[model samples]
Structures are given as C-alpha cells and as structure tokens.
Target: MAPPTRACKYGLDCIRNNPAHFAKFTHPAKLVATRAAASSLSTSKKLKNQKPILTSTPNTDAPPSLSASDDNRDFDAEVVAATHPTTASIVALVSTAVAPDVLANISGVTPIRVLADGDKIAISSYTIKRTHDHYYCTCPAWSINNRPVDARTCKHLKLVFGDAYEAARLLWKDPFGNAPPAPAIANKPKRKKQEDKASEDEDEENDANTKKASSTKAKKSKKNSDSSSSASSSEDDDEGTAATKYSAKNRAKREETKLKMPALLLAQKFEPTKTDPTGWWISEKLDGVRAFWDHERQEFVSRLGNLFTAPDWFKEAMPKNISLDGELFGGRGKFSETVSVVKTNNSPHWRKIEYQIFDSPSMASQPFEDRIAKLNALYPSKAASFLSSQSSLPSSSSSTATKNSHIKIVVHEKCKNLQHVLALLKTVESKGGEGLMLREPQSHYIGKRSNTLLKVKSFYDAEAIVIGHEKGKGKNSTVTGSLKCQMASGKEFKIGTGLSDALRIKPPKIGAIVTYRFQELTNDGVPRFPSFVCERIDANKPSDAVVCILKKD
Candidate 1:
C-alpha cells in the first residue's frame, strides 16, 4: 500500500477512524496505519483488519503495534509516555529493559504537522531528525553553531516543537536508576506581568515538591517498549506537553557552551584644538547601524553578542574565515531604513543594504596603514586619498555598486591641515553626512576607546534613560508628545525633536536607554538643545562618556 500524500484539513481533531477516511486523507497519528495493517496480516493472519490501530497480538513475535479504545486501557502506555514526556520518560527510554539503542528516537515518525519552510521562520527543504536523545538539523544555522552536538538546535525546531522542549531535552546519565518526574512546563509571562509579580516563588516551590514525590513511580512504568512502537509521536500533543517550563535550578543542569563576547574598538571625541588632522586618515563618518561579522559562526552579532538572522544569500557573499568590524549601511542618512531592515529576521530588504567594512579584528596586531593596504588588495576599492582626487559635489555616497557586490571598503583621505578638515566637515554635514572620522597614521586597532581613532561631529551625542513620557499637544495628543529622559550625571531634560512619526506614536519603554544629540551644555549642566537619535539595543545603561564634549570640531 502507498502512503497518503494529501493532508486532511481537520487533522488531529478529526474523529473519523474508519478505513475510508484514512485512505482519503492522512492524519499524523495514523501515518503508519496503512503499512502496519499490511505487515500485521503477514505475521498473524488471524485478527481481522477492520480497525488499523491494533495490528498485532500481545504475544506476537513481531513488534507490538499500539492498541487503543477497543476494550483494554493497557496499550495507552506509549501515549501517556509521549504526551507528558519528562526527564523520567527519557530515563525509562534508556532503561536496562529496553534495547540500548531504543532511547529518545523519533526519526521514523512523521512531523507533528506539515510546515512550509523558508525566510522569516522555517528553513526550506531542510531536514530535522532526532535519534536516541540527540537532534540533527541539516540547516546552515544549526550546522554553524559552535555548541556541542547534543545542545545544537535551529529555528526550525524552535518553531515546531518549541523552546521549552529543547531546553529540557538534555540526557540523563543514570538511565537505569529511578528518575524524577519533570516539572510542569510554563513560559515566562509578558513584560508588564513580570514587572508586577508575587506568586512565582510559591509556584516554583510546588513544582520542586511534585518532581521529588513522583520520581520512583514514573520510572517503574517502562514496559520493555523499545520493541513497542507507535504510529506518530505528535498525536497527544494538546494535553501531553510535559516539562514545558522548568525551574531555574532545573534549567541550570542542561548542557551549553557559553557564547564569546566580541571585543570591538570604541571611538573617542575629536578635539580639533588639541588633536592634529595634518597627518591622519580622514573618512566620512557614516550614520549606519553597527555590526560585527563573526566568521566562526558565519553570522552577524551585535557588540553585546545577540545574533542577527541575515538572509542566506547576503551571508554567502561574505568571507567564512576572516572576521570583519563594520556597519550595515544603506547609503548616507538612511539610518532608519537600514535599522528597520536589519532588525527583521531574514528580511528581503537586506538586498538594499551594503556591508561597509572599515576595520578587521583579525588584523588588529598590524598597523592601520598595513590594514588598509590589505583591504585594497582584497577588494575593488576606493583609496583613502579620494578627497583630493574629487570635489565634494558628487555625494561621497555609493552608486549602482551593490548590484555586483555586497561589501565596500570605506574610502579614507589624508588630512591636509586643521582648516581643510573644518571645511570638509561643513561640506559633509551639508550633504546629510553624520560628520567625519580621523584615524592616526600607523595606529593599531585596540578594543578600548583611545586617541588613535576620533569622531569629528559638529554636535555632541550621548545616551540617557527613558524615564518618562509626556502627552503630545493638539493633533499629536493621541501619541507621545515628548520623552522625559535623565542623563548619567542626574540631569533631566525633555527631547521632542528628531523623532519619527512612527516612534512618537509608540515610544521606547521606560527603562530603555536611547542615544541623543545636543549642541552644547548649559551652565546648569543640562544639554542646551537635546534631540533623540534612536533607542540603543546593545546596552541598557549609559557610559560615563554620556554627553561627550568636543571643542569646535
């Protein structure tokens, strides 16, 4: 008999169990019914094939096909084990009574339900299989993880079975020993509910007691069911989802490799009066979202180590062996558009974005001059002496270059004098450029902020805590009018400028830190004209350099 290819609309909820209904459309629970019925006949030739559930006798030489609501309740053991599959169920799977290889295996089973794979969530045509307590995904995201084999998981698994199951699937070393029942499953509540919490401690205590008391009884119930098989593991998922939530202590027992935090170089404020621009590398400071490419993981991560899910085509163009420090840019003054695209998972808008490479972390030991030389040699690039070659008329921005390439080396020019830098700064600012960046000659890239690298913006920028919100006046009254923020120095101010219509309507949360730009500081230590830049996702708290000063840059 052939397998059913078309899907039943009602699926698991369908009550029809007759042969006619089974042949017309497939149910995940009855996938093996057709094959099992055929095989069951060759073994016994006694039990009639009216019902497909019971294909074998209890005492048959063939593997016992699971029984159901016919008469006895004894055959529901596998269903019970699968529905609320806990740490105890995993132990019973590997116990001495069962075959050594018959533990936590679900590869032969069909998927819980059909899901189309591609883009924002699932992987197209990717295979996810589990065998004997270990999961394997053929997707690039899963393969690129540096974690151990048992701990590896992809978005596909998280999308289908969920994060709770993945967190609790770690193996038990003592399979033969009595195992405790797994704690009840529950995901963390929303932010508002979490902020107003009281009963969580009591719930955790009750779960701890439940696991301890039910351990031995749960362990004693495995009936040499390695040879005992089922049609589908997805059937009882509605009521059988066990260990969905585990206590903090229980989650601590799971295996994981800690993620390595990136060490990126920071910039300092350019003091034109003290710092000389006569013999340094000058480049147009791009107002783009910052990103660091980790070649080991084959992905882009923030400075704080949160992974960015880029499209497969976008990442394929990048080098798999070398690390890059740069920003995801969409030309000059396209900061909002670039951030919106980059924040989305597997966004199609990624094609519009270009990776602007400025420095290489791998070449940090080498001199800055030598690093630029390497970049020029490897890429079709614009040289650092670009300013003198062409006038500032043709927007030092990009062209139809992204059609053929995904990366571009930021062009740098040799600074002539203080007057020349000031003239170029005004020109760039007029053309909607952020400002200019000055790098000292022969300077090595270091992780911390140093005088070697400087940002020469006309306005001062800093971060502040989003402490409160004030309602808008007149037409804007329905949305947030202004945000009341506090500086690290304890000075508070209101910023109602530089906010987009979309942001003004929603606004950043109370505790979130946002970057703001100002002209200068007042005698009271407050910013004279504070304006919002954007909310910061990399850091929750502001650095001491908030409201950073620069004299006539």
Candidate 2:
C-alpha cells in the first residue's frame, strides 16, 4: 500500500485522537474546508521545530489593564506564537469543535453582535467583533483609546465568552478541562444545579457574614443611641419649659404616611454642543430634595413615596388639580438640611424651605415648554395671594416665612447657543451654583432617564443595581466596605468612597437601585471613579429596573 499524504495523515490522526471531531463532517463544504485546514496545519508543523518570529509589536498605547498587568497582559498572541501551534493549526482544531451554527451567527465579514438589553430600556447592546487575533468593541472604552490594533481585550469580550475567552487566547491547553478560575472582580457567573453543594456552601458563608454584620451593627447602634440619648436628655432638661413640650408634640405628630413613589423624569448627562442648546430650555441644576406633590392626596411625597408631613397649611396651599415635580430648596449648599427636613414626618425645619416647582407630572403628556408654561401660570410672579405675606413678623422671621413657605415656579430660559450655555454655566458656577439642566423643547415626560433631559454638570452621575455588600474594616468594621453594583451591561464593580457614613453603616439592600457619581465611563461602559451617591428610593426592584444611562449612537 502507498504511504498516506500529509493531509490524509493529519486527518487520520485528528480522527484517531477524537472521532467526535469528524462526526459532523456530513457537510461536503465543511469537509473540504476541514481538509484544507488540516493540510495547512500539516505544512505549518514543518516550521514547529524552528524558532518563532513575532511580527506584530506590542501595542503600548492600549488602554490600561482592568486588573493586574501580568494577569491581563496581551501576551496571549505572543504566547501562542512561541509555545503553542500556529494560527492555522489553532483555528483548524478549534473550528471542528465549534458548532457550524456559530458561523451562521457571524455578521458580514466579521462576526459582530450587539446584545439586546434586558428591558430594551437602555442604550442597545454595543457591537463587538472578532477579527483575526484581536477583538474590537464599539464602546467608549475601545474607541477612546484610538482602537489599538494589538490583541487587547475589553470587558465586553470577557463578559460574553467567559471561560471560552481563555480558549480564544490559547490560554486553555485543554478546552474540555475545567476553565481557570475567573477573578473575583470579574463577573462571577451563576452556578449550575450541578454545583448545588457548592451553592449551599456559599449560602453558609453569606449567613455567617450576615450574622457578624448584624451583631456589629447592633453593638454600634446601642453605643450611638446611648450617647445620643444622653446628649438629647441634657438639652431637653435645659429647655424643659418649651423645647421639651414642643419635642413631644413633634414626636406625637410624626405619623408614618406611606406615599406613592413619584413618577420621576431623570436626566441623562451630556456635554453641551452649539446646536444642542438651540432647541433646549436651560435651568439651574438645583441641589435640593426632589419632592413630588400629590394633588389628590394633598401631600408632598419624597421620590421614594414617603410622605413629607408638611404642616396642614402648607399642603392646603398647594394646587389641588395638578401634581408638580420640583425640589425642596432652603438654598444652595443646603442639601443635608433638605434631606434632614424631608426624611422626617414633621420637622419644624420645613418652615425654612420652599417648593420650587419646575415640571408638572400631570402635564407629562404635553410638550415640555407647554408644561413649563402651565406650571408658571399656576404660580404667576404677580400672584401675591400665594406668596408668603407674613410681613407683620420680624425682618428675619417675616422674610423667611414669605420666602420659605411660598411655592415658586422654577424659571427656565430658552437656551440660545452653546456659547450662551457656557456663559450661563460660568455665571452660575461662579456664583456657587451647581450646574445647568437642559430639557429638549418638545420632549414629553417619561418615567425614566432619557436623552431628552440632560444634566450638564461638571461631574456625571448614573444608576446601577446593588449586587452585594463587602464588609468594612477597622473604623468601618460594623458597616460595609463597598457596594458591589452591576450595570445593565452585566458589568460589576465596587463603590465605597462616596458613600455617606450612615449609608455605609446600613448599606442599601442587595438588588436595590443606587445612584453613583463618576468622572466618566471606561471603554467597557464601567464607570471610572465610581462612588455611591445615593439609593434610588423610587427605582423599581432590580429585577424589573429600567434605570441605566448607556451611551447611545
């Protein structure tokens, strides 16, 4: 018998080693492609004994690695070139194992997929393509770095493929064996039922952690309460004549009135362009408590649906037919005081606040300009009846009563141009104002964040779902280390720095919606310098949340 050709020998060897490799050779074209691949692999083997030559230099300009440089280095291609088989060999071997259907999934010359978001609410899934030995993602992170040609990877690639990413990098010597453990910071996948035992172990760990946290919290709370009560008692004793009586009355009037979560129209963060300001209305980004006026209930509700027990007179003074969305402002730099006043049932501190109505929730169906017009009409500047008229009181008291108790329509000016907007921003910030809010002229209110409304602040803010809480250490031992949060893109991260001490002590529950502040987003859509801002009390449960501000085309 004649000796077998190189291609024939290679095919025979592949079949012998793994018969399943050729089991799907039923397709004639596939068979031909496989044979050609095998032949190429056979020819490449001749150079296997020779020293490898690396043609592509490392792309030093690539973005910084998300993890340790050593672990996430772009050495995969170099490693394959030196230690493993050639590209032809690897592709041939890997192709046989890949289901033919996967090829059909490929779009155009490169296989790209823009994954659809869960709620179809966020910016559509970004496009990602597998080309040669590298991957390209159509995300800010990838584009911002000028699209490096090297085999650099992004979080999107790791997110979609998971363990298979190792195989793509030639890091997995045996694809059939267990995949290397993914980093803890990586998106840890949900375990399969086969790992029920392991899941149970994890549950036990969580329970132990929870018990420890609870015990620590209890101890801290007891200590804090003792100190607070002691100080409160001393003050009460000193002011027993009227302060004690007033304090008791305040406590008695503190009724827990459950309110409906307000329908909030959130703002998308964006930079102003010359044309962008043309068709928008601009207003100051008030740093105050978001309050929703429930017309029918004759009450003021917090974003989380908790009732703000404004004095009976205050609620009665509000319009009866319309629901208004605005901020409760004492003034600039009064955020803490605003929060303190609204969070309680009946804080006399409310006397020092004003409800600055901006948008009418009932007018959400109307154009934004029309809504503003109607809101302004409801509280006209000349309407002295609604304005605080306690001029008979002392200068300080009279002025505060008139300014604080009265409701005022927030003024919004038509944005003339980008230069105008910039000049206005400068004027506002120069005077200690926060920033500017831009509302698309014709936009109707939506119960979610939309590009129609943009917050052009110095910093950016977005929302994510709380996935877990990391335990704190030392000074924060009884509280939390960081809030592990997940975006709609399935990206996970920890936010600790911006958290308030109170929030850290009792972090938002897992699956709660939390707002975060960041300087910008990475190429992978992960927030850079992400820190906890506040819990989105009005947000729907995590499972049904539609609160994410993904970059749009």
Candidate 3:
C-alpha cells in the first residue's frame, strides 16, 4: 500500500488537479494542519524569528548574479488577519521596488507562478520571490507550518518553477549557495515563519541574516532617542515610530548607497562647414534603445542607468570578458518595436532584436579604431556570410553577427570627404534609416557630448516625460489629442502631431519618457512643431536627459 496522504503544503489553496499531486498530498479543510497534511513536519520545530534589517537594492550597473547564498525573500501581499500572537507579526509590507515592471515584463524571471497541469497561471495575482535556490511563499500554511524553513514548499513555488524544480531546490544540501542579494532599496520583505519554525528560513537562513541586523526595535529606539528633543523616554516608548517605519515604504533604512551611474559617450550634431569628415569613421545611426553591457554582472543597463532584461540566450551570445556600449536594434524604422521588446522583462521578442555595437566602454582609454578592432576580434565565427566586406577595414573586422545568432557589429566605413558623408546620409535616410553617425579618427571615447561623434538627421529629436494628456478637438474629439510633456529643464510642451489612432486612444502612461521630433528649439528653448516619435527609457522617475534640449532621440 502507498504511504499515508500528506497535507498539501498549500493547504486548501493547493488547486492542482494533477492526479500526481492528489496522490501525494491531501488538502486540509481547517487552518490547523492535520496529521496527514503536515505528516513530514517535526512537531518540535522552533520559530527562527530574528530581528529584521534593511536590505539594499542591486547595483544599477548589473543584475544580481544567480548564486545560491540565501536571496529568496517573500515580500507578499497585504496580510489578511492581525498577528496570530502565537506566530510572528506581519508588521510591514514591501514598498514598490525600482523598475519592478522590468522584472515582471520579462517572461519568466519572477517567482509568481501557475500549475502547468493544473490551470492557467496569473503571475500578477501573487507576490512571490523565487531565487536560484531559495523560495518564499505568503500562504499561511507554508509560513506557519510546523516544518524546517529549508524544507518548506508551497503550491505557488511548484507552479512557477514546476514540480521537478521545486523538489530539487528543497533537497539541495547548500540552500544558501546564492550570494547575498542586497535586500530592497525600495521595499523591505518582512521576516515571517511557521508557528513552531524560524520566521524567514529553517535554521541557518533567517538566523544568519538576522544576526547581522538583529534588533529592529532597538535600532529605532536609538534613532528616536537621538531625534527626540521634545520628549525622551524608554525604548518601549518608540513602538509607534518602529511600527511606522517598519510598516511601509520608509522601512528600508540601510546605508543610502545610490546606484553608480554609468559613464558613456554622447553625440553632437554635424555642422556641414564647421566639422571636417575626412578619414572619420562613418556608420548608420541605428534607431534603437541605447544599452551598456556590464560583463562583470552580466546584465544590460540602459543609457540613464536602468535595466533592460534580455533573455539568457540573448546575453550568452555577447562577449563575456569585455564591457560594451551599443544599441539593442530590431531594424530601421522599428524603434518603437525595439523599445517594446527590450523594456519588457525577459521578452522572447528579443529574438527579433540585435545588439548592434558601436563602441566598447571597457576600451574607453583606447582610440575609437582600436575599440572597433577589439569588437571585431571577438566576433563569433557564426557571423552571416552576406555581410559587408572587411577588405576596406582592418583584417580583424568581420562582416555580420549571430552567436545564438543575435548581436551584430555596426558596420563602420572611413569617410573620404564631405560628399561621402552627405551621400551616406542620403542613402540611409532614403531607406527609412534614422541618419548617419560620424566618429573622429583616433579620438578616445569620452563620456560627455563632444565633436568626436556627430549625428546627421533631417530633423532634430529629443526626449520628454509625459506629464498629462488632453482630449482631441473636431473629428478626433473622443480620443486623446495631445500628451502634455515636460523636459529636464522644467519646460513643458504638447506633442499631438504624429500620434497614431492607437496611441491617441490609449496614450502612453503619464511620466513615460517619449521621443519627439522638431525643426529647432524656440527662443524660449521649447521644441518647434514637435511630433511624437516613440517611448524611450522609463523608470517612472525624473528624466536625467531632461537637460538635453536638443539631444538626438
């Protein structure tokens, strides 16, 4: 005969109809887990509640590497009931994380999951954190169950990673093999535990991390005592302050270590007579999202220092040792499509995209020619045959791109003269290209805008944040007519000229960074005849490029 049916780790929430699941675990009707439900649990299991501390955010330069050093934290949804008194209190909720959408938008990077054989999964319905090894769930059964934290499992986790995955993680001998994830810069995941088990982890997990930040109340007590000039009293008197700080967005009180901004080269406009083009490197200016590849951390960071979550295979195709500065391009006239794919977290649409490299930030000290040569040398042998000939360029230069068959070298040719520059511009623009970029020979890459790199465009373009929206007039009266936008310099304007019907009906989210084109800036430094182009980098914060009154889009 088979062993007694065990209580499902999810209790009643275990909605799996899989005969496989039903054969192993039984759903308990009551909140109190029955013998069959928690048969595997140790009755004498102890709650490993440790003092919670503030966790920092990951470096802006790269995503946290997938290691196994105890990174999984459950910053679940708003709790349903008050503290059980018997168990740890749900004293706080996770604050909104920075660019969390980037995580969610990526197809399968998050912890929220579904039962593949059970039912369709709605990832947004739950708040879960599934790290490389650790897993956390908000379900009361898992949180308050009489089991070791390392041994804890839930139906939610089973769904996200699948049954085989969840099983292997629980069985791993070194659960915390992943490196310490900087907690949350924006939100602090509260520590909770089973009725008789450790609050965060089984034994080693919560105790190790908590000992580092042991007394949250004591920390708050000292802070309040220092700040209280009007009223001073016992450590117990600051309960309200502790509760307030630990309850919400103000919770993460770790050292304020800001994300290090990446230094990258910017471009200036080409002046026909003023700037010389003879012997300069000329290439087509791709209309795609600008990204900096941080090889050390293995992630794609955007121009203003935000993440663009590319799929694993997409990143795998890139060079591993050197850092790169390039554009995530789809094709000419496909700027909006490219942004849509890159901005979404771990999107498969990435297959349609390519990392068209222009320069290498790692080789910033080297001349532009040398950087191009370095990129060409690292090019994979799988490069397409139908690419530009390297006969005119250094023998190191390759023709096309593809490792997983993505990532390409932006073809660069030396400018012979002024006519060569204009003719190239005409060719690119005629074929629906953005324009041409001219790089000065032997110029070392600089982070700041300079004459070393120049863009040739028919019309000027800049990015602005969407502040509000206004309804249309006349025939388009029902839909949105304009997007009220603001620049980094605090100047505001409306973009209504180039909006399509789809965009008009559903305008970009307020505060979205949108690209717009114009003839020139007004005397007051406003765009003239501005037309909407597409959405750009969006972190829901003030635009750093707002100061770029004429910065090319």
Query: In TM-score terms, which candidate is top?
Result: 1
TM-score of model 3 (CA atoms) = 0.41
Whole-model alpha-carbon lDDT for candidate 3: 0.53
Model 3 lDDT tens row, 349-387: 667777778799888889988888778777744333212
The 10-residue segment with the lowest total lDDT in model 3: 75-84
Off by over 4 Å in 3: 1-258, 380-404, 460-553
- The candidate that achieves the highest lDDT relative to the unseen native structure: 1
> Could you give candidate 1's per-residue lDDT for residues 372-448 as a string of tens digits?
77765667544434333343222232323454376767778888999988988877766656678899999998976
Q: Is candidate 1 or candidate 3 better by lDDT?
A: 1
Query: Which of 2 and 3 is the better model by lDDT?
Result: 3
TM-score-best of 1 and 3: 1
Report every candidate's CA lDDT: 0.54, 0.49, 0.53
Q: Per-prediction TM-score, please?
A: 0.42, 0.38, 0.41
